[model samples]
Target: MPRLSLALSLLAVLVPAAYAQEAAPATSPKITVDPRAIVDSMPQQGTLLTGLYATQATIELCSVEAGEPATTAMNAHRRQLESEMRMDDATSAAAYAAIKGDVEKAGVDCAEGSKDRQQTAEVIAIYSGAGATPAQPASPMDPAAPAPSATPADPAAPATPATPAQ
Candidate 1:
């Protein structure tokens, strides 16, 4: 009977530790999220996407370090970037492009941290509205429209034109 009780106690103490270990990884952060859902659901498409990307990256880094819950880390990251960057849809779009480049570079940096990866202009093409450079703002004032002359054209200057070269 003593042996049975000792076995039960051992199980009680060790089972929880084993269960705790099983749950340990869950506590760590997650990098990937349902980006599409977030993007589609957000009222501000541009800002959310950018913010999401930045948050994901931050969560990944934090997870790699502190091993906190991914969702917690993700929320913290989103708040941090939103506050620190003060980004709107337009700004967020711009930022996402930049962040994507940085994160890609980070991967290489982690592996080699030596050689420089040269990025070409083609690789960094900016896709503004409609995948075309945002239509040059239709100049409000027409270029063809004549601009007013500064000097009240020396009307006399032209008239003195032919002092008949006497």
Candidate 2:
């Protein structure tokens, strides 16, 4: 009877210990996130043009580090944006230079398992074909109709141009 009780006690302790060992979560590798780095990497301006330029710069940096998948995704995104807002060669170059400079200043590092690298992958995934729908081009205006005001109702306000039909 004593042996039976001892055996039961051992089993109770061992079973719970074994279960606890199995239930414990595995430790994951530490990931450091820098808020300043994240902020620095972001687009300086809220304009669509700035966003497009930032995307291009991100692609350029990620392509070299993250490889072909990044390149493919970024290129597709670039094409989509370009189809919407066609920029001339000089403008494109200038925009790229400015964006690239900001990115460089931000110290973007696309090394494997890095925060920036993960962010780049996420950007590629999100901005690639499936994520955002392109804006529909405005319909052609009837030339005979009176021309709409080029200036805003408030003279001090800047005029926002209608999106050109693609």
Candidate 3:
């Protein structure tokens, strides 16, 4: 009888311990993204709002080819844009469509080895915050800091070199 009670107590304790081990939640690897890198990589010539919209299109299109990390980054960035920009559903949809149409019109192809694919990869790297150097603050006293120039700025226009500071 004593042996039977000891066996029952051991069984009760051991079973629950084993079950608790099995029921414990699994930990997943953490993902980190650098906001500064993402912001620095935005198209500098346009209004920041327009650049963010275009970035959204880029992330959506490239994520199809770029896979999981891009998708994760895309979701994070999209949420940030929607919240920070205060985009209503209709406005967000319209902006996405317009920017995506413009990108397609510009012949962006996400296929392997294409120039567009390379650009997309670069953009994804920025979004992924992988191997991205931290952006240095611009200082007026720092000669290495980029000087302001008389540059024409337009969202739809092709990029042109800024005039050299005299």
Candidate 4:
């Protein structure tokens, strides 16, 4: 029937228009990180990644197989971790020792994060240097414009209104 066809046509046009209006997000979602999750996951060392990468970095100098003295290696490892984790020397040493023990006990080179790492609270927010925010909805008065191309625009083309002779 004509009524059915008209209703279908109206729905097709209306639904798309409604979706287009809400397509843009108002704000970007902030980064959320769970400490336990980060410790459990393994990250490939010497790899490059952008944004808030949830990767683990461990210092295994405390292992007996290393040719260095136990205290010496531990101190060096603690120092490295302190700088990396932005923690004090004592806290960093404790954190490193905690992980080192876990790895050694398992007779393996890697281990997951342990509960002894008291430094990690239940949840934490991590901010990566690479900034990425969700696209915001365009204003009704002014529509959004596409990014400019790499090639320069024509010099003669006037972007703004021509200034009257003063």
TM-score of every model versus the real structure: 0.23, 0.38, 0.43, 0.24
lDDT order, best first, reads 3, 2, 1, 4
The sequence of per-residue lDDT tens digits that candidate 1 reaches over residues 65-131 is: 3223434544565556655656676875666668767776666332222222111111112111112
TM-score of 1: 0.23
- Stretches off by above 4 angstroms in model 4 are 1-78, 108-166
Q: Identify the candidate with maximal lDDT.
A: 3
lDDT of 1 at 38: 40
lDDT tens digits, residue span 3-73, model 2 = 99999999998999999989999899999997667354433333555665665676577673534565676
- Give the C-alpha lDDT of model 4: 0.43
- Per-residue error for 32 in candidate 2, Å, reads 41
lDDT of 3 at 45: 27
Scored by lDDT, model 1 comes in at: 0.51
Worst 10-residue lDDT window for candidate 3 reads 40-49
Write down the RMSD of all candidates, one decimal each: 26.9, 21.3, 22.3, 21.1
User: What TM-score does prediction 4 earn?
Assistant: 0.24
